[model samples]
Target: MITSTTGLYLTAFLVGLLGGVHCLSMCGGLVGSLTAGLDPRIRRDPWRMAPYQLLYNLARIAGYATAGALFGGLGALLLQLDAFQIMQRALYALAGVVMILLGLYLGGWWRLIAVVERAGAHLWRRIEPFGRRLLPVRTPLQAAALGYLWAWIPCGLVYSVLITAVSTGHPLDGALVMLAFGAGTLPNLLGIGLLAGAAARIAERVWVRQVAGLLVIGFGVHALWSLFG
Candidate 1:
């Protein structure tokens, strides 16, 4: 029944890992553009560029963790209301459904989740200008700022994971869950910044995406099944 905190962390991480194909499509272009804006010397040398990439991604993950904590707190507040058990069950069910929808979206089998992204479009527009100002990144700070701002970009994948975080019902647990998820995403995004073209090509493969999608779907199915078990 996935009782352990460790199990929850693993699920979050696997979801992030399996969802990399979607990450490639959603953030790959942005990563490529940002990397291109780096100082010529840093952009040319792998060793020099590595630090900027790390800072950028780490800041982005930090943003996710921040959001997760906030949402988790909200979930905890909700559970304090009357019928706490009912509320908890409802939240869990919602998390499972969102995960299933995310899996479908990742597989390209359904586009409904895009609607959720659209809902956040206005907020992203406001956030995007700040990111633009950070461009032509000459320092690690700029890259980090850019990454932090980009974390607010309208993304179904991020939102889906946030739902799972909210189900944790504890701010610290939620933050940790997202931290693990962000760690899972680190490799693919880092690769995109450093090896943009190759990473994009590999992620573009139809079978690779389908397989990842199915695996994620299995996680959701198990989550639902566990409720009755």
Candidate 2:
């Protein structure tokens, strides 16, 4: 159960750390495209490419934390209304339920999470063209701007952890939770952007994703138990 601020942050981080393995396939193409957009000079030199990649991903993480803050604030605001105390509990429970389903989605045992993903796909489609406008990035700031837009890109993993963030009912705590989650993903996504071929192979392996998926499932179970246990 994510009863404490630190526990929530850790849970969010674990979700991103373990679940990010799946994003290799989902976001690898985007990472590739982002890299490919860079000048050939940067592509040829690993040192030059590092800063741009880091900036882009950091901006993306900022977007995640921003969303978490907004949603958490909204949740907090809602709680100010009468009879909303129970609603807060419902939100937390819903977070746990969605998390379990997301794990199943990650594990390839179910596709229920796609419903959530699809719900936002339209909004993502609208936001995606903005990223295209920044292609062939000339500066780290430009890449970072593109990343900020891409943060809203639809993905079950992001959405799963975001739901948990919202349930925190505090803007700062929610932002912190998402920040930790984003940090967890930093390693994997940065690795994928740097080593697409190797990351692809690892992502393609069935057992690798399954193991990571199971851990995510366990997190969901733990979250639920924390609520009721």
Candidate 3:
């Protein structure tokens, strides 16, 4: 049987993959723009551009992993406080509901997800300036740095996944979870950066988005049921 831990990782990756579809819908142009910012020569040569793209994503994933670790650490702290059992239950329940909201956001059903994102904007602004300094990237390090900044860009998808990270209640566990989520998002963001329109088209398929959304909802339901069961 798949360990519950492994299952969580798989789910995180799936969530990332599904989020890619959403990214294509919402951030396709942004992906394209990242490429546009690349050196013209690199942009023109596929072989040359591959490394830069990879570096950018690697950085982004690193950021996600780091964030997960922090969230997990906080969760761990929260779990140790008074009424530990109640706190754990509450945390899991919150995660379940957030997952449902994520599914809705992915399905284009509940746009309210953005409210969470807007809350993160304050943090993003603080980091945005630093990211700007690396713009028009000329080196792998620069690309990676830019990606680290990109990871902080507020999105409901990320926040929803963080809720899962929070439930892990260990820094390492949280990091691993977010790393999985980041990996899931990789295909979409990476592909659009490379294939642009073609990949975006595939991501934009309504059926694909709906299926991913339903799966997310199922995860949430399962989570809640487990709590009550």
lDDT of 2 by residue, 1-229 (tens): 4567888888888888898876776778878888998889889887889998899899999999999998889778877889676776777788778878878877888988889989999999899888888987888889899889988988888887777777777898778888998999888889977775787788778888788878888887877787788
Instruction: Write down the lDDT of every candidate, Cα atoms only.
Output: 0.84, 0.83, 0.80
Residue-by-residue lDDT tens digits, candidate 3, 131-176: 8788767788888888888888888778877877877778999999
Please list all clashing residue pairs in model 1, or write none if there are none: none
Ranking by TM-score: 1, 2, 3
Worst 10-residue lDDT window for candidate 2 reads 83-92
> Which ten residues in a row are the worst by lDDT in model 3?
25-34
After superposing all C-alphas onto the true structure, candidate 3 shows an RMSD in angstroms of: 2.2
TM-score computed on alpha carbons, candidate 3: 0.91
Error of 1 at 182 (Å): 0.5
* Model 1, C-alpha of 60: deviation from truth (Å): 0.3
